[model samples]
Target chain A: MTVLDQGLTPPAPDLIPDPAVLDLSAARRDVDATLAGFLDAKEQSAPGPELPPLIALLRRFLDGGKRLRPVLCVCGWHAAGGDGDPAAVTDAAAGLELFQAFALIHDDVMDASDTRRGQPSAHRALATAYTANGGQSDRAEEHGLGAAVLLGDLALVWSDELLHRAGLNVGRLEQVLPLLDEMRSEVVYGQYLDLQTTGRLSDDVDTALRVARYKTAKYTVERPLHIGAALAGASPGILAACSEFALPLGEAFQLRDDLLGVFGDPRQTGKPVLDDLRSGKATVLMALAVQRASRGELRKLRAVFGSPDVDEQDATAVRKILDRTGARQTVDEMIRTRREQAMAALDHVPFPAAAVTALRTIAESATARQA
Target chain B: MTVLDQGLTPPAPDLIPDPAVLDLSAARRDVDATLAGFLDAKEQSAPGPELPPLIALLRRFLDGGKRLRPVLCVCGWHAAGGDGDPAAVTDAAAGLELFQAFALIHDDVMDASDTRRGQPSAHRALATAYTANGGQSDRAEEHGLGAAVLLGDLALVWSDELLHRAGLNVGRLEQVLPLLDEMRSEVVYGQYLDLQTTGRLSDDVDTALRVARYKTAKYTVERPLHIGAALAGASPGILAACSEFALPLGEAFQLRDDLLGVFGDPRQTGKPVLDDLRSGKATVLMALAVQRASRGELRKLRAVFGSPDVDEQDATAVRKILDRTGARQTVDEMIRTRREQAMAALDHVPFPAAAVTALRTIAESATARQA
Candidate 1:
């Protein structure tokens, strides 16, 4: 499991006070249970029987995610001194997971990626479902793509529903809406930038990082924290602190992902290693390699980068070039620096001690985990 | 130029009352202005310059459509006794228009339709933009589709932003949010049902009607009316009346559209006659034809239905079969009946007289208009 999975191991209970308890694993379960319950309600209320299969597909797609955003959302709330029933924020955190599902389903469709988390991507699974349900083979692919798009749309709206239903009191609803809106816009913009940069062997590291900031650092990290903090009626200083802690950790998270996309074991990463190289994903890792590569190496990289037919041998060659150019080392250095920056932000964050401890563990897992 | 395109129309000044004013043309303009202003702020505050082209494309796409839902939303407000400061509902109405844009862009992408409203579809247009920006020709189509998905996501979120910014007060936000959420969910269900039935030649008239009801009736009409009335703190009776009028009128609108897809002139219809036939859209009209066709006629219909290469000649053959089976006349009869039902419902609606008059006009245009 990746850093954010929080796949259900209860934290030892003695260390924290009753009110400010921050159990990451239990939080993940609550988010998942909320998601499952929400979908169950949707399925029941659906106007027709045909909807259930799509809902089922979505349920399956949602199963393996580490649920990073949702976990961080809860962390942000507790960090800002939220107390009493955590139910409303849990619902909002669940909404963040649904939003992540929307983002990933659409992202897979855009990339035409064959698999996600070791399962057929949403579009592929949908296509298979089509033919399995008696659709002509010729129409299966198109049907799958259309269904996936619709599914993603459904997830997005449902996410909004959850967020709206979180039922925060005392006008907190109004306060959090704008933050959520900004989060959605930022992620979409980040995705758009990624689309622009993908399939192009670019040495533009700045644009790549901007994409990461919007797509991952802000979307995956900062916005969820800000939203949760805002829900708790956090002060400006607390919100700022959340951002300072989130941004660097988020970048480190993405940088690790980029590295793993090419270098990590498929069993561990839950994705084929060749996807990024084949799609020419404009990661900072690839950008630095391009910037530093020798002329012959650049030519070889060009031949394989963004090539749809890229295989293990070609990937190995690219890895060799990255190593030779010291680009990999640079990325490693960047990850280390970002991690340090994140850990340093915690020193004077003014959070509850328990929150600091929880966040420290998150930072460690985020920067160092294989998946 | 379909029935909903209140394309800057000016109703006779003598018709609608001042307090219950229903100037379709002016309302459309207000909605457009609101949309433009919102986008302007978004563009100015965007994190980077890359966002504008997508925004521009969306703006151009937003142009020329009849703002039917927005107009109906305002009419619903006025009908339900909303008064003084129509500004909030106007913003909400504009949000409806943005939602329509999101729906249409994604719809075109799903159908792989090359053109919409006589211009290249969003995916196609995005592909052109990619090539124009000197992207490799080979990747242009993929890039276009991906960008279109991102663009559509942007529009959906932006639509939510608009609705959120509508600035309702007095806990009215609570009343309206669920209605908006339901509207979104209903449309998605409709789209999914549409995908399931598309390209499958079937005589399941009930299923086809269900698809149309979800995709068009509730989504296109009832929900917009409900949302507007809810914003005005409409009572349950008023909400029920809105639905009574909306559902039948909405069904009539879809039935009329189905007819136009086949029989109406492309010049007036703003779409090719062959599109519906080519996609094998599971319309009530097609279901009727299939139900009634002679063996030989059914064979001819099946040959052209869902065939991607369907041309004018094939459409003509299919049209002949529809005429022979009397499906075309039956659909016309259904539209007329539904229109009557809508008119009948409006007669007893506890709305102001001006609302009745406005509803009558909408009913007439929705059933009888060409483009």
Candidate 2:
């Protein structure tokens, strides 16, 4: 029941109007156009036919996913009063997206995820294609897996390639490099903690929370935003304030996601019910539930928590235990509190009113949405 | 028998030195000292005790491995008539070694190598430690594998970190960056070809050789030398000549390695008899053997090749087939011819007499050694 094990698969009953529909600067719109063109250009530069399958895998993996991180980066740059050309901004944003692509590909393989963003995961997709094609059936699975793994490595290498070629200012790049390094290092360490934390429910709550912060919260929001802000030459004081706002916001975001993973409606979440429960995620909410459960509840939870064969009846029993023990309410309250804390942090930072308002709206919607 | 597959392992007895008593230049010696200091300095900077285990793994994995790449870099700088402070050269050399570290770590994981430099591979070593330390037996293997994977990523990131902090001339770094990218991209693509070539022993010989050249020949020796030469601002013509010299020598080095993997003395190679046969490596010799084998010989090879459970009898049969088909002698002749071609290329380059002599000596020793 560690924070890392907390619910993340939230369900959205219906799609909401774009929270980012607030009037964007002309520069921002131009940046978006530029990004679209850049991605198109990358596709046109595919090495050869031998590489088409890999490129397709990337294209499919990237489809229909929210470009939230890149959007945040653009917003952060704007909020910091940076005035780069649209091309520059777009290049930076695309670099961020490529980095995200790399991270997601590796993370999927690491998690053994069968799907991502409502489609077959990259490895599975490649495997499917391999079999459908003329490849040998006996070795096709291994070949596809190998290809997917290498594709992830290629993406990571290409991320740096994109950044190196982006023609950004040296002063700015030097400043941003360490921040990016820290982001990478912390996230990896956070993942290490996460995989190591299973069944260690009685560990310190603060330790679990810190792990969650590094693994999900910072990587998801803070670092991406900081990258943009750093490029803008934001002072340390200002960057610190943004991190303060981002930390709580990111934590709330993950907490909400965790809640959705288990308790959210399937239609809203684009997922089946109790995915995290079935996966045996060691989340904060689960920890809280385990901590406060009655002896009988604890015994039942221990019996079925990680069982691959847990039936619908067992899932219902676990859900009942979650509700009866008041952990659900506790987690819900925590999410609300964190969201409020994020807003409070923002109050101390000076930002353009429109961007600030947009960020606030995003915070509220992110935490409160059904998904 | 892809070119990339040729250098999949260490060079044969005739390509490498004793793996001991190799002469070290002042620059290389200085770089080694700096690396020791840097490793110590880095230990104090990590977030927790987690680094110790990782560092230990790296130390074990790196120990006894020849710093040939780094040495090549330093020698190249010298050959190009560059005269810089010893400390700076060492820092730059460290950069090269760090990159090598990244390469080796990732390569081991990709190859599923059980041992490196006669010790348990990093992943297996970590997994062994995890089990011995009372970690969950079920996940001990996974933990080790994941840790090693992440460790490789860390080495890559930190390799850049080292270069960034090396305080080398910005102009020099710019000159080197594109070359570095090419080196990395070519190596990865070569790996792709090598992996894709498995069981393709009867495929085109030229394609296999091409893969081998890119994967092993270029990356192992050519690029490291180029990095040094580029930093020294060598003329394009001079660099071109260096490449001509390096390419074939590198190829010969790998060809020798393939021979050792299959037929060299087991004690010296530190591997079992027919190791490559069991592992199913698609080497130049294997491809050649397949091409020249009679129908009966081909059947025997098909039965033994890539079989994890290949027995001594199967190994003897396969060896007999390779010998009978004259493939072993052909490969040996190929290695000799490539070595001669490498020396001939050096004749066209107008380097200083001392440099020419030193490089020639290295090439001669590198290509003519046994174990």
Candidate 3:
């Protein structure tokens, strides 16, 4: 049976609610408070003083995130007709943020990225901290990488702790756990797929989109909603509805990210514009461009794509080729189509009106964000 | 309350068994079968063809392990008078092995080590595979590292999946999970401490032992036993007994490993003898030697320690000083003492006679094995 068929019975009419509204800003605050309190307890109860710095590093890294997953999770709960103080949902939401911290920290190490969220990435920050603390200068970089890895590991495990303590009753926990596991495996597998395709200029748009689906669509969008709805004992139909809305919007979100990676202003994006070009990310935009490039344009793309030291001039030249080939415009059109599809799906979903409105806002913002 | 105090009532006499006999080798075989089956299912169900190689890579990695943790987990189960068919316990045992695989893969990457279990390390193996597949040779190394990181992440999450599917009743799972979480956090913290002290050698014996306690004693021994016993609804007293026996044995085991790392034959140890010396492992033995070394010995030690290119001659000289300073003999004495303590603890523990005998055997083999 499909996930949508898991709950065969329809919800009683008495259980259905009129459109309900939630104060999202207040929900975010509760999530942040949960996270802060959890970290504080961890620091206070740490086995040794040496652990505090790592915990602090994670806390700082967490501060820069937009809390999108947490927000979506709370929205999912509301969509499923959940009624409560939202304390448990907030705790789970915070856990998602910690998991994201784990992912980004390790991603930076794997990519050897120097910055994140307009600040030094975890490893870079750690390296600077090591030097400031009188460590040998030569060993700072390796030490930072190792420390950040351990920190990431801690975050991953602690995320589990947070979820366990989220106070989900046994039945709810059993329902949530498998989806959480699936989300984790999908994202990791997606990353592996991305790793395999990276640095190789390919026109395999299907593979690129598959990466987007696993890495972004399911992991970033579908899973959080599913998890939150599960916490509310959402019926299979309600979960299916959430997935229907999430997938296309998630894909559009990632596509917009790809465009911003290469074309957006560095100041606005908080990352260098040439990073995607230099890394030769196996993005759908790049694949479309490759599929349609002329011989001279392909040569120019090949010359600078995946180069370690690609320059602004090289990136500008590649952009010209992308625009000339209509790949850029095609991606924009794809985003619009996907966004519309997501909106249409939302219209048919059995969510409260306020929930639908919040999701719509999220979709629009996610696809149109500068950063 | 102390972990030992969790169960206030004594285990009834009827619950105790006479020295129970178990076929440990058979248990190991069963655990291996479980792991193999699980991986087979994962490979068959993977979302894409690209994921098979990673699953296969993990299977091969699993092949090289001694299955020490799995054996300990099963033994803990038996020690706690766990009855009936061992299928569920074996699944949990196999899950522990997968967790070890996760730990080692990341550890190898962090150490930048070239080999494991006499094979190229995961990163190196992936690099070789990448080059063989006609990828750019230079990019192969970075790609391999990235892929290994993802592979490690997958193993970690999949380990959670395995444990979840081990079919413990809800109450039993509740008892086991917190221990599992504690174990994960302790090891990460241990690794973090190790990282902080790795390259900068000092006579900080307490710091070195703390690393051993967290990284090896708790993670490798105590927690596995605790988890297994918890699965059987073991009394707090029994868990305390397990810790009493495990901690010293675990520390001794790590001490033996430190000696092996510097002096064991590569063929027997399945790893190069020069790694610890080259890496400047701030092991207890090294710390003791540093504390007691004379001026000339200190200079010689400084020259060879932490040097990536130290040769046999250099290792030989370092070994001579280790012997001359009595650090080698002192470590041996420390192992002997700790082993005795573990044995003594086993004697007073409330375990079936067979369990106690098996614990003794493990202690002897672990502390004295050539490899």
Candidate 4:
């Protein structure tokens, strides 16, 4: 039986409590410290100089992040009335950060994105490093790509090591492992859908939503919350409550991102406005536009949507079609609906007051942020 | 403390003893069955139709393998005198297979290899699948790489799941987790080294040997043995003995593979002979040839080596240079020396008689095989 099933809860297995119920900003700092300490240990223990370069890259890549998932994880722990010992929850949060790093590094390579967080993407940085190290010019890019893949892999395995080190007892372990497993499979399946759909403009709104749900809704939100709850040895009712709140909020978060990818200022978003359209990112917004487009607009979209050489003028033309077809407005309405639904979920459960406030703040920022 | 450190061993926590002392052939079947069952469960529980194609691809890819790692894992268990149920150990063996699959899939993508085991490599096959699925031709190859990376990742996580599900008790888990963690780091570091060295045509024998040791000897041979021994909660002395025997034998195994990769018959080896040379795989044999080559020969070597267009004539020229420089003969002697050292290690330890025989047979086959 799980910790919740027993008449009495178990004591801390190893780690004693760290300071708990910190506000979001404080929680971010703790997550960062845990990540830094873990990676510092890894670098110190690494056998050769060769690994330092990769480690350095990972540290740099991790420097810029919202830390939303990690913050949510800690909040979830609190929401479940998890008393004492936030250390393991902190480690789990750090692990979520590492997992995100792995996903982004690989995603950049897959998309051939040159920049991330306003710096060179992992592959780009590695390629520059290759050339700086006097590698053959012709082979540098391929070498960079290969190295990035390996680096991503290293990040992934290390994340698991962190999770394993969380000092959870058997009961807690049984609760967490399957949730972690499902998170991994879901994100990968989501990526698979994204890759297959990219470079092809389609009117399949269902697939587009499925992509959003798998990629963002569950992986980015629900799993982190669920993992934190599991770390607390939460009951099934608590986990189900997390899903209800997380799924709609996560979807709204992704919808906001899809909008920002196209319409938001690059200075705030840190990505070119044309990137999503140029890459033909499969999104509900695009699918809706495709569904409603006239023949002339459809032809225009076909010409510009996946074009590598697409100019601002071309993007403007596509944007006009989306506006004209009411697709953008519809997506805006969808976001509102999801945001309201997620807010309703929060009221249905009587979580800690602090956790409720944190969740509300997170939901508002996620749906309303410029970036 | 570990199971061995305790005054007396505890009973099996979950899995009861399966039959033990079976030869490698019988062990292979058990490992295969475990993997099949695990994967079958994954397929059934997967949420949608989208995952089935990827699952099918993985099942097909797994259909071909030597099962050497898994078999050695079982052998290590017996050698360590691990008594009682072999079920957990078998699950661990199966986990090793999935890990190997993960490694090979990503390696193929990194190397951009066209084939593996006489079939289209994972990326190539995945690309074919993408095109077959009505994906645009321009994006199909990229889709395949992304999918393969994801597929490899799934295999990796699933391997961890299998290991977790092995039903080993706390003592076994404590003993096993670190070894597993180290094995992962070592192999990735090895791959990183391999990527840096490939296509450079360096005469750095030390670096080349380091690559071989890290990439092959330790990862392919020693770790599997170590993990198996750990599963049995092997005493430190037995674990040390495993390393002594494994390292030299593993090095020899790699040396033999280096030779066969360039010289073995394609029909037997299931790989085109030109592959290793064309990829400029950093092997001690190549390093030795570079070190000893005349100016004229070095120029010819540079022109033909690492060339995608390298033909049989080019390979013949390289072979002639290798022979004339005494590189091939020197490698053969090195293999002989290492093999002898490994054989001598067997004499120092009083391993189970059956295990010693199995280890000897594996050593002979690994070092002497034509393919």
The models' CA-based lDDT, in order, is 0.85, 0.67, 0.83, 0.81
Query: Tens digits of per-residue lDDT for model 2 on A1-371?
Result: 12222222222323224443333334345545554565566567644345656666776665544556666676677667666364444566666666667666656665567777777877678778777766567666666656666677667666665555543443465667677667777766676666555433432456557666877788777887787777777788768877888999888877777777677777767666655665566777778888888999988888776555777788789888879988788878888899889999878787666557667766776687675
Off by over 4 Å in 4: A1-21, A83-85, A167-171, B1-21, B167-171
What tens digits encode model 1's per-residue C-alpha lDDT throughout B55-121? Answer: 8999998995778889889888888898788788888899999998898888878888788777898
lDDT per residue, candidate 4, A13-127, as tens digits?
A: 2322433334556667888999999888988987777888899999999997667778778878888877576788888888988988898888888888888777898999999
Best by lDDT: 1
Clashing pairs in 1: A2-A371, A5-A66, B1-B371, B5-B66, B6-B66
Order the numbered candidates by TM-score, best leading. 1, 3, 4, 2
The sequence of per-residue lDDT tens digits that candidate 2 reaches over residues B231-350 is: 778788767877888899888887777777677777756667666777677878888888888889888888788777888888888878878988888888998999889888778777
How well does each candidate superpose onto the true structure, as a TM-score? 0.95, 0.87, 0.92, 0.91
Candidate 3 per-residue lDDT over residues B25-58, each given as its tens digit: 6777899999999999989999999999889899
Arranged by lDDT, best first? 1, 3, 4, 2
lDDT comparison, 2 vs 4, better candidate: 4
**Which regions of candidate 1 are displaced past 4 Å?**
A1-21, A168-171, B1-21, B167-171
Share of the reference A-B contacts seen in candidate 2: 0.15
Candidate 1 lDDT by residue in tens digits, A267-318 = 8766678888887888899999999988999999999998989999999999
Residue B99's lDDT within candidate 2 is 67
